[model samples]
Target: MKACIITIGNEILKGRTVNTNAAHIGKFLTSRGYEVERGITVKDNLDEIKWAIDESFGKYDIIVTSGGLGPTFDDMTVEGVSRALGLELVEDRETLEILSKRYKELSAELTPERLKLAYIPAGSHAIRNPVGAAPGIWISGGKSSILVLPGVPREMEAILDQADSLINKNDRFYYEATERLAGVMESAMAPIVNRIMEEHAGEVYVKTHPLKSETRNPEIDVEVSAYADSAEMAEQAVRDTIREILAEARRMGKK
Candidate 1:
């Protein structure tokens, strides 16, 4: 399945907030054999968010969005999604009760702004946020599904974990392996990397990232990920690719 992640926040674009949510979601979904086609960070504008959702529906099988699910004025993710899908925005009774109970537990007021958290797209299945006021949402139509989670890291993690069954319904069982070379440069290994990509096209994904370290003259981390019918086959493919790359390094007089 192909996936698209939308991180809705102007802070992300301005470099004020790092988009760790996209990284986590990408890794989690890819492990289940979903190829993450794109990660987009959009401003908190309603039109922009709606445009992103509408565009994703046409191209991706699974669309996951994080952020813009707060009580503040800037929180407009739900509205954008509703407008994009032509769904009605209505207050969900269950979600309202959940939010009310949460606020009462903390001896806080269920203010008008806070009550706004209960509103969602008319037909969406509300997902409980174990750690926060806003609830996540899940909606499926035909062959596509969209999961909207909170911007908070802990809340997003909890909601995703809780809804694992729904997200992983189409299990594909993918695997990835990483090997770190203590004294290798990414530039020096480009040719070998290209050769590996050509030889194992569509069977394996090989990427090299250069790392700086005080203990080693140069370091390059090679990550190989592959999807196969069995875990053993996937693991062996990555191991074989790593071994081949290392052998090439040794032949070039790099220990």
Candidate 2:
């Protein structure tokens, strides 16, 4: 299954906060064997969110959205989701009561605006919240399912962990991964990685994320992930690829 993640917030774009939700969710989904195709982060605008959702319908089997589920005016994730699906937002009394109880348990007051968290798009299934006020929404249609999770890191993590099995049970894939090599630049290593990928022909992904240091030279993460039928085959392919990459690195200055 193919999955895409959408992180919503202008803060992310403005660099006020790093958007870690995409990476977190992508890694989780990929570990379960799902093919995480793209992870996109967008501002809190309705048009952009709706456009992203609409465009992703035919391309992915699952779409996960995080952020913009707060009480403030700028928090319009639910509204954008409604617009994207051509649905209307209606208050869910049960959800509201649940939110109220949550606030009460925290020794806080639930204001009218806070109650708006219960107003979800019509025909959407509620994903129970154990750590936050805004409950996630689960909707399936057009050969895809979308999950709207709270933007709060802790809350999203809780939901993803507690509800992992039930979220998308049947959608899993196998990925073989191996990483090696230290001081190599991605641009310089791109041609070799590309050639190796072309030679393999199966679903493979090669990426390099460099780590910088002031006291020492930078080290690159030469990671290769591939998909196959069995764990053994995947492991062997990755091992062989790593050996080849290591040989090439040894020939160069990177050790």
Number of the top-ranking candidate, with lDDT as the measure = 1
Q: With candidate 2 superimposed using the best TM-score fit, by how many Å does residue 144's alpha carbon deviate from the native?
A: 1.6
Clash totals for all candidate models: 0, 1
lDDT (Cα) of model 1: 0.87
Where model 2 places Cα greater than 4 Å from the true spot, the runs are 103-110, 167-172, 182-192, 208-220, 247-255
TM-score of 2: 0.82
Estimate TM-scores for all models: 0.91, 0.82
Q: What TM-score does model 1 achieve against the real structure?
A: 0.91
lDDT tens readout by residue for model 1, 89-161? 8899999988888889899999988988898888788998888888999987655799999999999999988
Per-model C-alpha lDDT, please?
Answer: 0.87, 0.79
Compared with the true structure, what per-residue lDDT tens digits does model 2 show for residues 1-255? 788999999889899988888889988887767788888888888888888888887788788999988898888889998898888998888888898778898898888788888898888877777876788888866667888898999999887786576555543446556564566666667787888888876756667666755226656777877666666666677778888777777777667
Error at 55, model 1, angstroms: 1.8
lDDT of 2: 0.79
How big is the positional error of residue 143 in model 1, measured in Å on the Cα after superposition? 4.6
